[model samples]
Target: MMLETGKIRENHKAALPYYYRMVIEVPEHFQALPGQFLQIQIESKTTDPLLRRPFSIAGLSRNRVTVFYQVKGKGTILLSRLQAGDSISLLGPLGKPYPAVPGPKIILAGGLGAAGLLFLAKNLSLGSQNKKSVVLLGCKTKEDLFLLDNFQDLGIPTYCATEDGSFGFKGLATSLLTQKIKKIPGKGTLYACGPNPMLAMAGKIAAKHGWSAYFSMETMMACGIGLCRGCAVATINGYRLACVDGPVFPAEEIIWGKLPPHPPLSPKGRGLK
Candidate 1:
């Protein structure tokens, strides 16, 4: 489904102001994963944010592609007014990504889930060039911090939570992932994406210890690819298709409040068909 058909080469706002970011390009083998997402087409087809928004894919160069919005309503305030070359219309490197293993890892983001964890923390700090690899961001204040200095300039190792605690671990970055899940390294691995009560408290603390998590569901999409169905993500072995099977699953296959209800879609609505 990769069509990025790009244009808009720059657009910004972050450090809050309802968050925003653009930088499109598309074409050049267009490869973007890490909790994949894309599905623009801001308006037209009789306007009014007309269906097609789903962003996240927040950093990638060479041919570009970076869309990270959160202006929330009126289709992201009509996509923060759009600019730079304009054009726009994408589909995506779509769903299913985020799966890289090594040693120490943990990237849990909240609040526009740090724009799909800024290209998944720059692809795990450029494939473990090692900097102690860690990134846990949460926001409720402190300018709703975005990109924490671009994942600390790729050396990763970032942590910030705020709920009036004003900054760095005031509370709930899953409570510093319960003190760094007892010092990580159960072969470390727990990638999250945020909201849905912080992926249900990081899937209840990575299912009480047996780690290896990965949950990037922000749902509520509109054809980010998979012919729409308006973003549905219910697991328990019945419904799965968050923009094509997943916006990244496996936080123990998520079935948290006993989910159920999804199936049958056609007009790009019902949650990523």
Candidate 2:
């Protein structure tokens, strides 16, 4: 795909403090799937905060793209300053996108991990009657919640959990998932992305219940195009690359927190069925 540039059409903070959404115009060639991400270069070289960052597409339209992110680091803090009409270079519609499908859905997100799962919920639930999506969003407090109404507006049920008991559930989102795993049918699938701990927990839960799930990993990448091999991960058979293999995988296939002892041919290479 040709590298197309975009201008930020709107940047606004939602209910979440320091978490914002930047909507930019996507060129005609930029076709994005849910759970796909874009690499954004923030123009603040002198300042410690204006480095580059990657954000998942939170929502999409025919002409524009929106990314939602938290102010966790310097790069994001600068990108938050983008406003309507500000131009930015985007290197995506990159990476693989979450498979858009129908079934009882659960968007499992932890903190910033919500970015990848939110768009999937929005895309799949579009035009469904009483959307079956059950989005479990985890944060430290109510101030950390993102796009609460966006899901509700789509008729998707959403649940919020904060460590401080400032919202819906007072425990971890995985704990909430633990309780509901048995309720889903055979076709039910869990879509998760977030911190390592959250992903680990989800992996364990899915394995125990025999439920199908997809995971979007948070890996460090030097080159987004699968060349540098900096983001190699251990698989059940051996080490696998995250970029070319997957940023998304079946819950049972990944090795979890560490690389597998040996090299496992990536399910990504052959499209594991």
| Best by the lDDT measure | 1
Q: Which regions of candidate 1 are displaced past 4 Å?
A: 16-20, 23-35, 38-66, 69-83, 86-91, 97-108, 116-141, 146-160, 167-169, 176-201, 206-214, 217-247, 253-273
Report lDDT per candidate. 0.74, 0.72
User: Lowest summed lDDT over 10 consecutive residues: which window, candidate 2?
Assistant: 264-273
Query: Candidate 2: where are CA atoms >4 Å away?
Result: 44-51, 127-130, 259-273
Task: Give a tens-digit lDDT track for model 2, residues 1-273.
Answer: 246678899887764456677899978667878777787777724534333466788878888887887655556656777678988877776677776555676888887778767678777776572356678888767776766667667667788888889988899888888877666656467888877777888888877876678888767765566777887766775776666676777767777767322232122333211
Best by TM-score: 2
lDDT for model 2, please. Answer: 0.72
Error of 2 at 50 (Å): 9.6
Residue 99, candidate 1: alpha-carbon lDDT: 80
Residue 76 lDDT in candidate 1: 67
Per the 3 Å backbone cut-off, how many clashing residue pairs does candidate 1 have?
Answer: 11
Q: What TM-score fits each model? A: 0.33, 0.85
Displacement of the residue 152 alpha carbon in candidate 2, Å:
1.3
